[model samples]
Target: MQLFYQNLLPEINYLDQDESKHCIKVLRKQQGDELDIIDGKGTFYKAKITDASAKKCRFEIISTTQERKVAFHRHLAIAPTKNMDKMEWLVEKATEMGIDEISFFQSFHSERKVIKIERLEKKAISAMKQSLKAKKPLLNEIIPYKQFLKETDVSNKLIAYVDFKNKIHMKNELSHQQDTLVLIGPEGDFTPEEVSLAIENRYKKVSLGNSRLRTETAALAAVHLMNLAME
Candidate 1:
């Protein structure tokens, strides 16, 4: 089923400007037409269009359903890559695979110091609609690496690091049915001091795999692993 997103649902029954245009002008939806809407907070609504205005198409709710609760929550924290396209790709794929939250941080070896959270959020919204997911992953702005390490609280905390002898795979480290957060470093990888600090904060050092992966790839891999653990 095709789904339109409008975070404000039962409270305010109208699509935003962009969504309104798509529903009316692009898709040619008319008054009395039925459509599915998601609030991006695990709620889905079945509604009938009341006004087909291209600027603010309004709808009346027919029914509402909440998304099924997952066995575990997956949160991925990573350093944004130097290339914006790569980061966008990561967000899109991770959303499709059912990530709960994504956090970005600036590390000592981070190549990209700044990121546009709004753009990434748009990508996530599109991916959620495409994948027929009712919930949208929370996209957080870039913060200091140390700050994230200190503030993050989850049942299972992991840091993807390059350590030949560490030998602990991320998949093996994850505990079933627990909220997990994995940290992926930047292109240049995390500094030793940063890894040490994360360990001090109770983040376990884990390896994604034998082969070295890019920052975005590592983050997606972590998300994928977390999803698998839930299954």
Candidate 2:
């Protein structure tokens, strides 16, 4: 089914400006065409087009479907990389792979200082539609590492860091069906003090693998491994 996205639903006979433009101009869809719409909160609606204006396509809801809640809750808390494209790509792939939430942090050695959450939100919505997912992952803005560690709440906490000469793997540490949370460090990796603080706070130290990975790569890797553990 053809899918469209909107953050809020309009009550009257009006379509979202962007959805309308895509329906009328790009798709050239006509009145009475069937389409699917998602509110990005676990519900889907099948609608039939009523008006076909390029600026304002209108549709009537024909049927509705509700998706089940996620079986496993996974959150990836990471330090955004220096390249904006890499971060955006990570957001897209993570959403497509069914991530529950993503948060950015400013670590001791982080190269990026600021984040544009608005753009990231848009990218997430687009990925949701493209992947035909009913729920979109939550995107959080840049936060300080210490503040994030103190304020975030999750049942299972893990830090993906390799000590100077120590080697351990994340796949060996995770348990199934847990509310998993993982911290991925910056390009320079987390400082010894940061790692020590996390350990003191009950965060388990785990490694994705022996090979070194970029910040984004580690984030995505953690996400995939977490989902695998649940399955």
Candidate 3:
């Protein structure tokens, strides 16, 4: 089934602008062609083409369904990088790997600030549809590290850091039953004060592995390990 994204629904007879172009002009789908629509919050509808205008192809819902939630909940918070390509790639991969929520934080040594979330949201929806997943991940607005910490609430809090002077590993520290929040630092890593503050708040220190890793790599590795721990 051809899948399309529309965040709003009860969306009676609305044609997806880009997907409509793809349907009418690219795929050349005509009226009555069967398609599927996702509202990105677990809602899936089976629809048929009603109007096939390249810019405004319309559809009618035939049936609707929702998917079951995952066995474990996850949220990954990372410092946004200076090179946006890496950050964008992280968003895509995290969505494919089944992350529940993503937050971009401006860390002490972070090189970038003021991320544009709309593009990331679009990337996430595209990845979700491509993965054939029924639930879409939440893309949070970028914020400062302190504010992010103040606002987030999770059962387990983990900070991925490599202190040559201090040793810790995520595998040994994370609890399987609790919803987790992992903080992946910037390229330069989190400042000593930031690490101290996080530890003060009960955020455990953990390492993704022994080898040194880039910020994006650490973030993705954290996501992978979290999924594995739940499994």
lDDT of each: 0.90, 0.85, 0.85
Cα deviation of 78 in candidate 1 (Å)? 0.5
Question: What's the number of clashes in each of the models?
Answer: 0, 0, 0
Best by lDDT: 1
In candidate 3, position 101 carries an lDDT of 92
Q: Candidate 2: where is the Cα deviation over 4 Å?
A: 10-13, 164-168
On TM-score, the candidate that comes out on top is 1
Model 2 TM-score (2 dp): 0.92
**2 against 3, candidate with superior TM-score:** 3
lDDT per residue (tens digit) for residues 12-125 in model 2: 555678889988899999999987888887778888889888888888888889866777778999888899889899999999887989999999999998989988898999
| Model 3: pairs clashing at backbone N, Cα or C within 3 Å | none
**Judged by lDDT against the true structure, how good is candidate 3?**
0.85
Considering TM-score, which of the candidate structures 1 and 3 is the better prediction for this target? 1
For candidate 3, write residues 1-231 as lDDT tens digits: 567877776555666688788778888888989878888888888888888788877788899898777767789999998999898899999888889999989988999987889889888988999988777889888899998888887779999988767687897766567789999999988999999989877888888887789989898989988888877
- Residue 130's lDDT within candidate 3 is 94
| Candidate ordering by TM-score (highest first) | 1, 3, 2
* Model 1 spans > 4 angstroms off: none
What TM-score, over all chains together, does every model reach? 0.97, 0.92, 0.93
Instruction: Encode model 1's per-residue lDDT on 95-115: one tens digit a residue.
Output: 999899999999998888899
